[model samples]
Target chain A: MANLTTKLGRLQMKNPVMTASGTFGYGTEYSDFMDLSRIGGIIVKGTTLRERQGNQYPRMAETASGMLNAVGLQNKGVNYFIEHIYPTIKDLDTNVIVNVSGSEIDDYVKTAEIINELDKIPGIELNISCPNVKEGGMAFGVSCAAAAKVVSAVRKVYDKELIVKLSPNVTDIAEIAKAVEDAGADSISLINTLLGMAINSKTRKPMLSTITGGLSGPAVKPIALRMVWQVTHAVKVPVVGLGGIMNATDAIEFMLAGATAIQVGTANFIDPAISEKIVEGINDYLDTNNFSSVTEIIGALEI
Target chain B: MKKFILDLQITHKVQLNKQNVLLKLTSKDLLPEILPGQFAEIRVDKSPTTFLRRPISINFVDIAQNELWLLVQIVGEGTKRMAEMNPGDLLNAIIPLGNTFTIPTDKNAKVVLIGGGVGVAPLYMFGEKLNRMGYKCVFLLGARSQSDLLLLNEFEKIGEVYTTTEDGSHGEKGYVTQHSLLYNPDFNYIYTCGPTPMMKAVASYAAKNEIFCEVSLENMMGCGIGACLCCVTDTTEGNLCVCTEGPVFNINKLKWQI
Candidate 1:
């Protein structure tokens, strides 16, 4: 049997198939469809310092192989998560990682600091790459210096496995990844949704209410894989690759491209059981290849 | 709030018009109680463009036979592929989603149902349920013409049906709200679903007369569950998921332009 265990700094995962934040709500929403404890980890929706109503109506638009979303991280704040959400998920067998988002640097630090106090949560995935919000999301993620500033500030207040999620809307993604690594980020996840948009010709208006939105789905796998490979070589920290991974084969491709772990995003909308299936698929691939451990496949690209 | 994912086999497919088809499907397990205005998220596998499931309102449900009905209109890649499907083919669906319409409980409550275009799908089930409960049911159905109007015979069995065609080929001329039946002040409750403009007009009229009204919204949805905040309809309370909080909501809850 192949060992599916994976470790990123201090945090360890049962498998490497974590559900992307925002796509999987609070870890409990998908309990009706599949077992939450079976997957690697569950990253709850992006939480801020205060309650957010998010963007206005008509926030999503469907494109050719994927969809565009401007959901703007609509959560009931970090305090709400501590008061209501944390207790329910605290005892779940799988690792519970919180995806922290904020409109300001202090909000990010405060949210991370609160999550750090939770005993059950082993890490916080710093979401510096959300494109939908009007301020401070992709702004911090776009530049290497800005990315390092947020990671270093949060690292001082929180002492858990800090995975910095990177945005693809930049000139050089590997440079940003290295900057976060240098600033004490435990690991890195890339690339957050690529910035894109669509237009309705008949109405002559932009499809999303926000005019432009972050794009995710099968359309972004090649770019995500390319970045994962580059970032893996550029940084010593582990890389969690996620873009438009839909199935097991897609997940395997990410692992081969040097991703230490993989997060399933828009694919969860298509199939809620995709993360579980990916875990099983990874085990099956390892068994077929006569590899005793899943790590052998990481960064195993022939090129 | 029970949810079931079933591989339903197509038993019958009837092309109602140039754009619409009535599909009949049967599942192995007994279906749970499904209310009027609730919908099923159908997975369209054939089309690459349709990665997310399509939310279609339940037209009818036969508990005894474990049969389900969906009225699909060929409006996009998903429905276009669904239209080409033949009998004996399989369809995967998540069912019994969203909230139901408020069933009239008062002894003297008179109800009117208004539907436009493919929006008329859920009204048959609503009318049938109301008819079973001994309530007076009336319908104001709108279409492009006599040929565009669907299931008048099915609706007539449960209610007094009135229709309007855009080209004046049917009952009353002009839009559904312009029909003479709407002018009558007898109805105490109004239910509407269809094009946004038509529902808005009906909702406005209902609000003006102080009648209880509800409208089912068909927003662009990703996950039929509340997780993906994609299909949200703005309401007085906040932005609520159309897939969960409603496909059915009282007009009072909705903050429409009217």
Candidate 2:
């Protein structure tokens, strides 16, 4: 049997397949469909210090092979999560990570400080790449200095594995990845949704209420792969590849391109069991190829 | 509250009109307990444009025979593909989703159901449950023409059925809002699911006459579960997940202009 266990800084997961933040609403939502314990990790939705109602109606629009969303981090704040959501999911036999977001650095730090008190939460995927929110989401993500500042501030309070999620809307993604690493980031996950727009040509109005939103799904996979490969080489910290991964083949490709782990995002909207299926497929592929451990294939691209 | 993902076999497909089809599917496995107003999400395979599961309401369920009915309209590519399926074909569905309509406390109360276009799809199950429970049911359905009005006989088997066609080719010569049966709001309760204009009108009339009322919303959704924040309906309590919190909501909770 191949060893599928992998690590993100101090955090260790049984496998390399984890659901991306915001896509998997806590770990409990999919418990009826698949075994939550079989998956490597679960990154809950984008949580903030205070309850955010998010954007207005028509938050999602479907495009060819992809979708745009402006759901503006509509979570009920971290306090609700710790009090209500945590007790329900903490007992699940899997790594439950929180995806923390904020409109200000203080919001980010305070949220992390509360999560640090929880023993069940293994890590947090610091979200500096949310494109839908007006304030701190993509603002800190696009610039090296802002990215480093958020990471540094949160790193001071959050003792767990800190995975800095980077935005794809920057001029050079690798530069931003390196900045977070220097800011004491334990790991990096890249290619958060690319900003895109769609117009209802008949009505001559924008499809999403935010006018422009983050684009995700198979349409963004190729670009996500390129960025993951670049950032994996640019920083010494482990890189988690995401953006538009749909299936096991896509997950394996990300791992081969140098990602130690891969997160499934929009694909969950299509198939709730996709993350579990990808885990099974990765094991099957490793066995078929005569590989002894899953880590042996990381960054093993022949080119 | 129990949910199941099952591969159900298509037993029959009855085309209601040029636009709608009634699909009867049976499962060999013991079906999970389901209530009226809940829906199922069916995956559309082999279609290029449809990558997401289409959410459809449960129209009828014959628990004795393990039969489930889905009323589908050819709204887009996804529904178009569902309409073309043949009997004996297998369809994977996630079912018993969302909350059921609140059954009135007074079983003897007079109740009315209003549906607009394909929005009337969920009323069959709602009417069936009410009829079997001995509640008085009055259905007011709206469509474009005589052929556009769906499942009149099925609803007739359970309650008093009324319909209005845009072309006036059916029971009433105007919209459902103008139906004579609706003039008196002395009913104990009213339940509605239909076009926004019709629902707003019904909510307005019900509110004015002090009739307790509820309306089902047809918001465009992704992941019929609450995970995706795509399907949201604003209420007095704030924005709630239409998929989990409701597809059916009391009129008082809704922040509609009426």
Candidate 3:
């Protein structure tokens, strides 16, 4: 078998098949379908400083080859995670990263500091790109200045590996990536979900309770690939790519586009066992191509 | 319960009507112990417009024959595709997802199962369970018309079946709540599944009469697990996932207007 190990700054993965935030619950949810240890990493749901009830009902709309969601970070706050969720996932063999979000800079810093104390958690994916929430979320992600400010603030208190997750709603994602990298982000993961909307012609109303929601799935793959390619060239920090990554081929495409590691997002909803299947698919691809290590393909695109 | 994702082969397909189709699926191994009111997330392959797996309720589980039945209503692209499957086709599904309805201990307790349209799907299995346990079952089914009503013969075999059609072509000339049978006294418990408005009306009736009631919600879902958090319903406890916490819930816990 070809070596499948990959790293994003200090965060090393057995394979590059990490699950995107909001898709995979605490690693325990899928323990029945596949071995949780088989995954490279599991980014738990977005945890904010305060409890959030999230958006109203009818929060998801299925589009062609994609789906839209306005589930605005509905979590029981970080304390709930530490007290109730942490103990269960702490012993998992794979990397259990927390996806942290906030309405203010202090919220991000405080939450990150708490997660930094957890021995099992090696990294935090700073979520500045959740489009569903009313405050903070995508607000800090759209502007390079705001993105850098949040990352730098969290950097002061968070001692673990800091991976800033970038939003695709902005005009120049590469500029935002560079700003976060300069602000002390150990790594950058991109293309969080594209802002889009769906409408019901008959009802003359929007499909989702929130008129607009974040779009993810195969439909956003091309845009995600282009952004990953652009940001990888512009930033110095390692990049984790994700957008419509359905299978191993999609994961390989992200690696080729200069992503140090890749994440599988919306596809997890379709197939619970997808992440492990991708780990196997990546190994199969490496063996067939005669590549010695999975890292050899990072940014190996001829063009 | 431990959930299993299995490739169940289609043993039979019966088109009940233009809008509804009943599919019987079985696997080589014995099917998992599925409770009434639970559902399956069936993967819709080859359908370009359909992205997520369709959450279809478990209509019936014929244990002796090792068959799991799914009564599908062709409402959209995903279900329309499910209706086109032939016998011998392989359908992948995540079975036994969500909480089951409460089976009361008192066999003599008055129980009524109310359903409307394909909402009657889950009640069939539930009624069967109640009947097998020596509880007399009364089913009050509703449809738009006589032809719109489904599984009348099958439901009749297990319970005292009563129905209402909007066009007055069935037992009653109005909604299920408008039927004269609901006027009967001493209905200790009621279980219903149907459209939101219909369930609300049933909840209202049950609430007004001070009877214990439960209703099944058919909310738009993603990932048929707690992970997606898309199918959350407002309840007394707060926003809870309908998929994991319940496809079935006690009326008292729900924050319905009634």
> What's the lDDT for residue A296 in model 3?
98
TM-score of chain A of 3: 0.99
Candidates in order, TM-scores: namely: 0.98, 0.98, 0.99
Which residue pairs come into collision in candidate 3? none
lDDT of 2 at B3: 71
**Model 3 lDDT per residue over A1-303, tens place:** 999988889988899889999999886878889999998999999999989999999999999999999999999999999999999999999999999999999999999999989999999999999999888999999998999999999999998899999999988988999999999999999889899999999999999999999999999999999999999999889999999999999999999999999999999988999999999999999999999999999999897
**Which number leads on lDDT?**
3
DockQ scores of the candidates: 0.67, 0.69, 0.91
Candidate 3, residue A175: how far the Cα is off, in Å: 0.7
lDDT of 1 at B8: 88
- lDDT scores of the candidates, listed in order: 0.90, 0.90, 0.94
- Residue lDDT tens for model 3, B66-125: 999999999999999999999999999999899999998788998999999999999999
- Arranged by DockQ, best first: 3, 2, 1
* Candidate 2 regions with alpha-carbon error over 4 angstroms: none
Residue A241 CA error for candidate 1 (Å)?
0.9
Model 3 misplaced stretches (Cα beyond 4 Å): none
Candidates' interface RMSDs, in order? Answer: 1.2, 1.2, 0.6
